[model samples]
Target: MNKVKVLTVVLFIIAFIEVIAEYFRIIPLIYVFKPLISIVLMLLYWLSSTKKETLFFLTITTSLITNVLFIPNDLKFIFVGLIIFVFHRLINIYYILKVMKTKDFIPVVLASVPFLIVFFYIFFDTDLLTKEVYYIMIIHNSLISLLGGIALSHYIMNDSSRSSWLLICVLSFVTLHFIIFIEKFYIELQIFRPIAMSLNAFAYYAFYRFILIIERSNSN
Candidate 1:
């Protein structure tokens, strides 16, 4: 088999192991393997694709950093890690802006406003996080919503074959974040946490594939 196929196998194996470790409450194993998911997937992408887009690379790298930092299980560390993820989202926005053709900015602004208001309101009312962390959460949610809206706008404005895949990728990202919010704040069901984490990892892989599909469509 080729290198890409080999790497794909490795990535899946790693993901499976992570899920098992998390489900079994093997804290030591989970700590070791969970962070490697992003790193291995990033390597797979780097090896498989000839075109190395800077924004995509940065997104994956920051994601790796976020995953690694999150393994510590400290609120402060996780907060900092999420700050890095915000940078990841900002880079993604820059990339989306570059590829998207529609210049109608009003729709993007209007789409983001409702989500921004809702998130701010929810965070303002919540006692789950400190004031500083609450502000960070608001900023993070706002950027994620803005990114989703921008991606949706691109799909709406474009007539390309890749639009659907692009939309799926954006939706996957949004879903992953929503699950994260639930896992952190809304739920304490330990049995389901592994499932949520696995789903999050799968979403990242799906996002990578959709990006590759879009790039291929552009090339064709």
Candidate 2:
């Protein structure tokens, strides 16, 4: 596990260098470098039996790459954020249904509104996407989020109870704050990006630990 963590750190360093190099015009690496490094890191983790960790890293890396590569306006960023939020909602929905709990529809409806708006805007304003294709992105992202979230939650968790949910909420909040902090400040991207990544990794680990604890409790 320590070796896997070390490799993840190294890959993160390589990704940072690539992203910075492109940002400063030092070298023209493809924007795909970010996702490529992410895929490499994820593959390493998967080989090491850390599939949930791999998925978390891959999802965040893809989201960041999409944002950077698309060069969307502020409104569009908000639009994308809403899309991501809906993805989370979809995951939360699956979990709720799995546990036979009622889902709060307000959250689901609220999350979808922005993305729905973006869908129309893309169709009417840009030739890049036909109406059908725009909905495809929405469906595609939501499905990714749903599968990623459910698989991640289930893999990291070992119990059929609610205790792990607390860890999930905590970890999600940490990621949210990390993203917001980076956006709000002019800090060194390379320095803080890995720290954020590490937090996410640890949070997932903690979430798994919570699951184990709950499993033990239930068994006893």
Candidate 3:
């Protein structure tokens, strides 16, 4: 517990440092703190969760890789990162499937509509998305939408702190990607970069909390 508590604090500090680095354009700090985040969160999960979820750890690994790919700020690298992120979302969805009580298709579809709209509007906006990237976005955004929809469905059906955390965790990912889209594709919103990092940190914490809650819920 002490370890978990300390790591959680460390996570916050890391987020603060990374965001400040991003905002100030501190290259060294950005390089150092950015990668440290998932490492720390993976440790927190290892210490906190009673049942070690290999799937979750895999998610962390892929997320770390994806984040690293995104650090270059190159569109090509980011496109590859999106490919990896599709896998990350797949792992999350699979994990959620194992834990969630039921699957409601209607809720999933209804919940995903907004995200799909945003994705399509952006990808189809200009000459940015070529034939290949357009197809990739279709597959990628579909999975992302499915991931968010499932999380939202879980939250709606189960009114509890666990579900709430789950929803927050997923939305943090969604929002971070939304900003990434805006910054990378639409326009350069410099502020959104730090905001995305902060959301990433909070998402890690929320995911940790959600796991604990769901594990306890299952045990009960």
lDDT of 2 by residue, 1-220 (tens): 7876687677666666654644454424534554455456555545454224333443445454543543332555655665664555454445434432324444444444544454334335544544534664456444433433443444344344444554364446435443533443334454444444444444434433443344445456
lDDT of each: 0.74, 0.46, 0.82
Off by over 4 Å in 3: none
Ten residues in sequence with the least summed lDDT for candidate 1:
158-167
Return whichever of 2 and 3 wins on lDDT: 3
Most accurate candidate by lDDT: 3
Tens digit per residue, CA lDDT, model 1, 1-220 = 3988888888888988998887787888877788788788788778856676777778777877887787767988998998898888888777767765547888788766766676666556657887767777877888878977776766777745456666676777776676667667777567665776677677677667766776666678
C-alpha lDDT (0 to 100) for residue 149 of candidate 1: 75
lDDT of 3 by residue, 30-121 (tens): 88998899889888888988888898789788988888888877778977987887888788778877777555578888888888888777
Give the lDDT of residue 89 in candidate 2: 46
- Overall local distance difference test of candidate 1: 0.74
The lDDT ranking, best first, is 3, 1, 2
TM-score of each: 0.84, 0.37, 0.92
For model 3, what is the alpha-carbon lDDT of residue 112?
Answer: 81
